[model samples]
Target: MKAVGVVVEYNPFHNGHLYHLRESVKKSNADIVIAVMSGYFLQRGEPALVSKWERTKMALQGGVDLVVELPYAFATQKAETFANGAVSILDALHCSYLCFGSETGDIAPFLHTNEFLQKESEQYEEYIKHFMQTGVNYPTALSLAYQKISNRKDTLDLSQPNNILGFHYVKAISKLNSNMIPLTIKRYKAGYHDKDFASTSIASATSIRNSLFDQNADISSYVPNDTYTILEKYKEQYGVFHQWENYFSFLKYSLLTMKEEELKSIYEVEEGLENRVLKLIIDSHCFQDFMEQLKTKRYTWTRLQRLCMHILTRTSKQEMNLINQHETSPYIRLLGMSERGQEYLRSIKKNLKLPIISKVSGFHHPLFEIDLRAAATYFMIFPEPLRSRLLKTEYTTPPIRMSY
Candidate 1:
């Protein structure tokens, strides 16, 4: 009855993701797999190509036994906080192992790097800040500094996206002294940020979303038929991120109209990123553009995006800290579950510590509450039928697309 946990944002289930899930199950010899996924927004600081429930259903159909929501606050955060949030949830669930897709797929290197960094990390941190003062991007500064201190100049580019996120997972596990063993699956194909579906079977969510937006390029190959059917039903209904311009403007106005001191309450606002955000909100054409304008050497895009999302959700530093002190994940909310998943839940229901929620309004999690509302709000932006149906949609979310 051992469970393997995976933290994901299956914006749209794809072939590569399916491979990862299957490999994870086989590698871990897991009886059941639990995936803690982002609700509505993705890590890229944009609305998911599809809704959370849709993605949850896709996960279930795709092979994951159970799908749980990673609260919005964590899902849209920087790598460190994001990993912390996901790992904490998996640990809380008493999962025995974690298996994530990685470019290196070798845990030994990450483990070695983790030990070295842990034993001698203060110097690296100092070096990173020194580079930051020179106007290097935070991630680049971190990479450059780590290389200098570790004396692995040519080999220590751990800052590449997946590896960076992986490092955080390792760091968190070590810092927390958790027993969950970590494993990595070699990524099969398609780079994460790759914007086009180069192959018929393997593609990134970015590519699929791009297809959906372009109104051309057959997406029949990228997603499962079920997903296609779902997309067809709401193709015209879902408002793409581009359409969220008005919404972003609303957010900008909200920030600018607020008192200066009030802006300081938002997380990631230190050193006046808030003032920068407020000033540029009007100058930029869209959310992405706005972030570009606000990004600085001291703050990375991922970090700035997290800050922007926090602002949109009104997650204050005090509130975030208060919530963090009380609950990393207050309750494990099941988005969808297969029959096997249902059985697993039954077995762990009594032994588990946190409450499991299956509905939105029942949650008091500040971030969850906001994201759920935002999800509905975003759905409402879509035209008539979808807007109306998805507004109060519950389990109507269909099964995941796993039949690749």
Candidate 2:
């Protein structure tokens, strides 16, 4: 069976995502489209606006043939590390292509840029160090280094979120030298950071989440009917939509109570950030305000948010280092699947490079433990009734299987 892979968060799967999934299948001409989706938390260093199970159901309903978990270690990291884990999984699955939505739409530039960076690694590193000495953020430093090394004006565009991630996907593929082809689908309607929900059929997930959680605006037109229904169910049961803001008090408590040494032990905590967090926790009123007080050129809001989340979950550097030592996912944990997806899994089950985890009881890895903690963390803010029912241990909750 030919399978095309996508690395996604789905975070509630809006209309734009539905469009991309259909286009990916059409463009790849594959039998199955496998999605490796983030669990609980997202790459931007924030909790998802909805549960992963709900999002997985949305993906299956929308168009994904199969879905697998992208472990928390990689899911919450920077773009490069996130892409590395995702590409590695797809390569292990022996997918034919990797398709992703991008602002540029064209794949030529990403390929060219990846090749250039690979060929000039030493020079690029030197430039990066030089720029870092100026106290700019790593992304800014990397962007400046790329423009310097490539000596192309357009190379600066690599800094855009989608473009940056797409470039990393290509780079990871090249690094692995896997057979999978890389492709891009042009993003439509709203831009990645565009917070306004337009009247168009598609809107960014950011806009939809903001509308649902912040303004309580109607987002029926921006998402599929099934998605709307699922969201409404969550709303009635859980009050407002689940978001990072909902966990602010927990995060603040974690921050205020954690020792400096303990804070330093968490992943992404560095450069005396532990000290800064301890100092600022007292003055901050909420998550948004805490983030504002801590934001700086050296630390992006996304980076700080991720750090705060790590502290809340007690995700330690030692744990992540152990994962790196292992070099790949311990198992492929199925999230949800359609009929064709089931067939695809069966076809590859015999020759799989990693263990297939259909039952959570079989998991003996620390990474899976982290995943469980993350899920539990997500439910802490949920209303009691919904929280009780929804907080089933991973062992008890089977993957969502959709029959025709």
Q: For residues 1-404, could you state the per-residue lDDT of candidate 1 as single tens digits?
A: 89999989887787778889899999999998999998776676666766776677678777888888887767776677788878888887778888887778877777888888877779988998899889887778878888788764323248667878887887777776788898888777788788987787888877877776787677777777766766676555553533345357657767778887888987768886667776787677777688667876667666776666666666678756744664356667677777777777788788776777765454576655665655665565556776687776743443332322
Clashes of 1: 3
RMSD of 1: 3.4
Model 2, span 70-131: residue lDDT tens: 99988998888888888888888889999998989888888878877778999999999999
**lDDT of model number 2:** 0.85
Per-candidate TM-scores read: 0.87, 0.96
lDDT against the true structure, each candidate: 0.74, 0.85
- Residue 329, candidate 2: C-alpha displacement in angstroms: 2.2
What C-alpha RMSD separates each model from the true structure? 3.4, 1.7
Clashing pairs in 1: 57-399, 57-400, 58-400
* Clashes in predicted model 2: 0
Which lDDT value does model 1 have at 256? 71
Please give the distance, in angstroms, between residue 208's alpha carbon in candidate 2 and its true position after superposition. 0.8
